[model samples]
Target: MSLHADALTTLRDWEAPDDEQEALRRRYLTHLERHPDGMLRAGRPDHVTASTLVLDAAGTSVLLTLHAKSGRWFQVGGHTEPEDATLAGAALREALEETGIARADLALDPVPLLLDAHHVPFCGPGENVHHLDVMFVAHAAASAAPSISEESLDLAWWPVDGLPDAELAPFVARALARRRHAGQAGSASGAAGSSSDGGGSSRAAADQPSR
Candidate 1:
């Protein structure tokens, strides 16, 4: 399926953890319904973007990039590309491209973790643009070392509890919670003779900027 169709299906089937998230989920669905090209950069004013928050294997720290244009610390992500087959794939691609961490060492959770909508003043020619960002989570091997990409001024892994951007605390918390829940669920499923697995921001920098 196309990325747009994949995004629609993903969000439609996603069970939001809270009422606020459910509302945002509906908003994303509505946007897609109104604009067929909503998942692409060409969808003016508003478009869908994908991002991934990278965590250490122990979930102690999160890898962040000091965005070159926004000059703010944020997760690694960006606009969807023609090469991307799905929204989650786009997010994984951004994480890999922006972090310079080997794919072998970075494991992405196919399920999205959060959704954020925010304005970016630098995106449009003269008007601000809103990015409907779908955030995903990933875990990196302890030995994974990230190199800075052109999109970032610097990249580093900061303690999850001591993030440079305080606004990110909530996002990190949610991701960690989901990770733990997945772990528990996996154990439970395995104990039952089987195995099962399942699994935002803005700068006004709330979400990822168009790159």
Candidate 2:
């Protein structure tokens, strides 16, 4: 299936974790239904964007980028490209591109972890655009090292409990909760196995631009 169709299917089938999220899900669905080009950056006032928060294999820290345009820390991600087959694929592509973390070192979750809608004043000339962002989570191998991309002013792994941006706390919490839940489920099914080791060490790469 095409990326647009895949996004529609994913959003339609997703079970939102809360009433607010459910509302946003419905809004996203409505936008896609109304605008066939909704997944593209050229879609205008509102478009779907994909992003991924990279966690250490140990789930104790997350990778964040310092956005050049916004001068704010955020997960690695950006606009969807036509080559992307699915929303998750788009997110993974962004993560790899922005973090410089090899695919072998990142284990991305196919399921989206959250959704966010926010205004981007720099997205267009003389107009503000809203990004309907679909967020995913990935776990980096213990030995994984991320290099900075041009899209970021800096790249760093911050402890989950010590995020540079307070606003990201909830998202990190949600991802960790999901991880624990999955682990428990695997254990209950007698399929538990060791996850890739994610070292808790914090490190930052030099500066770069925005999404």
Candidate 3:
């Protein structure tokens, strides 16, 4: 099977309640479900499949990474390592390590959304392909700053609307739409219940104090 077929077929059967709508992206989901303790990447390659989308306060700035190998500006994410026990856990670790941020203040949650697969010109002039991407909702401190790490050519946040027209052409825009939907859902849910963060419903329930 082709790479795309290999990815889509696996995604079609991914069994996770949280990913009902995103089950189609299961091909990109970590191959760790069979092994509860950690991910098994026996056949996985260096291509990144899933990621965490971390946006700033105004919901305008998006934190991006300049990958060590690809040098492409992408989200904080990578292939599932044998150590990753869960998708969300891997997303969080990737964000912290790649973006160089402390994990304490983040209220980031997971929202499994399938990123339409497509190949875009990468780096200088060699690698050109898009690994299937499973994007998740992530958060970073409004005050926390980004420092470019060795993995990136440069680290900077750009106005969500002002991303380079060329680079933001397809996949990036699709990823952004998911974040917008999640934020809107959070707002609507909050008004109906209570204001809180962690996974939304959990935060709302926690807001109710026992009296």
- TM per prediction: 0.89, 0.89, 0.61
- C-alpha-based local distance difference test score of model 1: 0.86
Candidate 3 per-residue lDDT, tens place, 59-141, comes to 66778776667656777776566455555566677777777777764545543544544453442344544444556656566
lDDT by residue (tens digit), candidate 1, 78-112: 89999999998999999999999999998888788
**lDDT of all predictions:** 0.86, 0.88, 0.55
Which model is ahead, 1 or 3, in terms of lDDT? Answer: 1
Model 3's alpha-carbon lDDT is 0.55
lDDT of prediction 2? 0.88
By TM-score, the candidates rank as: 2, 1, 3
- Judge candidate 2 at residue 194 and give its lDDT: 29
> What is the overall TM-score of model 2 with all chains considered together?
0.89
Model 3 pairs whose backbones collide:
11-26, 11-27, 60-160, 66-152
Look at candidate 1 and tell me the lDDT of residue 97.
Answer: 98
Give the alpha carbon lDDT tens digit for every residue of 1-211 in model 2.
9999999999988889999999999999999999999999899789999999899978899999999999999999999999999998999999999999999999888788999999899997537689999999888999898999998899999999899989999999999988887766545434322233332322111001001
Worst 10 residues of 1 by lDDT: 201-210
Better of 1 and 2 by lDDT: 2
